[model samples]
Target: MAVQDGPHQASPRKEPGCLRGLVALVVFVGIIYAIWWFTGGRDGDDEASSTPSVSASATGDRGGSSGEWKAGDCGGPDPDRAPDGYEAYDCGDPDATFRALKIMDGSILPAAVQCPAGTDVIIEVSMNSGSDVKPSGGIPTDTVCGRNLSGDHPGDAGAGGGQLVKGDCVTADVEEIACDQAGPGDLKVLGLVDAGSARCPSGTTDPIRLTIVVGRPYDTVCGREP
Candidate 1:
């Protein structure tokens, strides 16, 4: 005999493969993430570690007396020093106005020093007071024998204006000037004579003597009247 029907209870619905499918999907996603993390994703960190750092001094961003300067290096006038001092610059840069011929220790006095034959100007860097035409006594000073690239005279520190090259044209007073600006009476440089030698090239009409500093052997510039 059938019993009286009690309240019918719904059995719990079971997903046959839904749970397993969800687990597999989670594992697949994790594997993909792991592969990405181990391969291309890790390259960022490796590249960051391998990259080289740029120094402020090399780019002349320090903007003051602090930086590495050497012979044959070119530079511009430092704005901080205003009418004096020098800042690092690329030789090929248009702003480059001076080329270093020699660097001397501070122990020597600027008055007692003689720069190289081709040096057109001199600059003094004081360790205690930045860059100055004159350094305070007893401090570390760096003397820069520089060749002025600009045609203008570099104040009193300059011997004259710019140093003359073989192809340069100069005025009758022995001042270097632009070739195009040369007048009918201007002279053209034929060659340069050594410090000890007085004889210029065979065709040199004028042998002009050039002096960089006191007591140093002077060079002779051979020039021909234009």
Candidate 2:
């Protein structure tokens, strides 16, 4: 029998390289897609990555104290006993009120209240500086102390009210303070009655006292005396 001529057949071209390249491309694409899915795809909002700081809302039903304090009224170490240097007082909770009473006997004591995180503070200085000397509410912008600061009490007198803040103090020039004030997040200084002229009721110069209402954000200022 005549040798049957094999049907004409062409050798199959090797496409392994192409197949390998395609596999590699798929793997690369899959890896890139996985990375993208894990990274920037979590949050769908178009907003910037940074968030702004915001004031926290007041909680609880406790109303703060409305008056100043005497030296004997405070417990433990007096907040005003700064040793010839700067000392800081952290009054937690905005609803909580703090008072600093310093008995001025020729020694100068400066104290400040600090608000930690999410809180603003403002400080007012009030004191009975003995003499008839009155603290001139000085510059209009510097009236960040005493009464209502939001201009709610327009022309209202004394270390008036202002925005509360954090890390601020009310310095004193005299003995007794009425109601000190502060705003959230702001560190302020309230001017006390000048001890030089403002004398005490006893004829002996009185000490400087400061009352701080923590937690409320105010717009008042404790500016330097003119």
Candidate 3:
């Protein structure tokens, strides 16, 4: 039987479906953000780490380590017997065997022809390697034309002639002297020519012949007015 309606009672509150959906959306977005942080966000650091690094020694600049030689630098053979490499040394050091006269691009064989007239030895860096290899921690390929300071070559046989090269100052007796200290009688070397076949270049006078033996001429150093 229908009873008289009592005072209207309030229904228990239920959470809205939109609020639940909003919470689920916020959780989903948070998960996506976390995934991105772990993956894409670290890409910059990974790329930075993957990039190749260059070292000071590979640059072949002045004051760099051994095998990285430049013009006017001093070095010596690493093993002294059929050396495969060179070790850099101070110019004044007693162990220094050769002085770099020039630095040329490419392999040693081709670059040897470009060496100065007085070059006695050649040091090659990264021979047979490509130029692009330097960025990957490889030495820059180059040829170092060097002059032997050990007084072993024929050019060094005579008195002070070994120390002299083209464009160097010398006395009438073939003694090497500083250009600043040269006197009126002193002469400047125009070129060093092979005495066996070639004559002194033009514009030069008083070609001093350097002999290794008593009669065999080794080289002729052409001289000019200082």
Q: Which is the leading candidate under lDDT?
A: 3
Residue lDDT tens for model 3, 79-150: 443334466777898878878888776431221234555666655554224433232223336666677787
Worst 10 residues of 2 by lDDT: 47-56
lDDT of 1 by residue, 1-226 (tens): 3334479654445454656766797899877765554222534221001111101111242234555457888877666655544567878888888777887654332223445556666655544354333312224355566776776532222222333446666776666666657778888877755647667878888887764532233367678875
For residues 41-68, what per-residue lDDT tens digits would candidate 2 score against the true structure?
4342221111111111111112233233
> Which pairs in model 3 have colliding backbones?
156-162
Q: After superposition, how far is residue 160 of candidate 2 from its true place, in Å?
A: 44
lDDT assessment of candidate 2: 0.26
lDDT of 1 at 202: 82
Most TM-score-accurate candidate: 1
* Selected candidate, larger TM-score, 1 vs 3: 1
Q: CA lDDT of 192 in candidate 1?
A: 58
- lDDT of all the models against the reference? 0.53, 0.26, 0.54
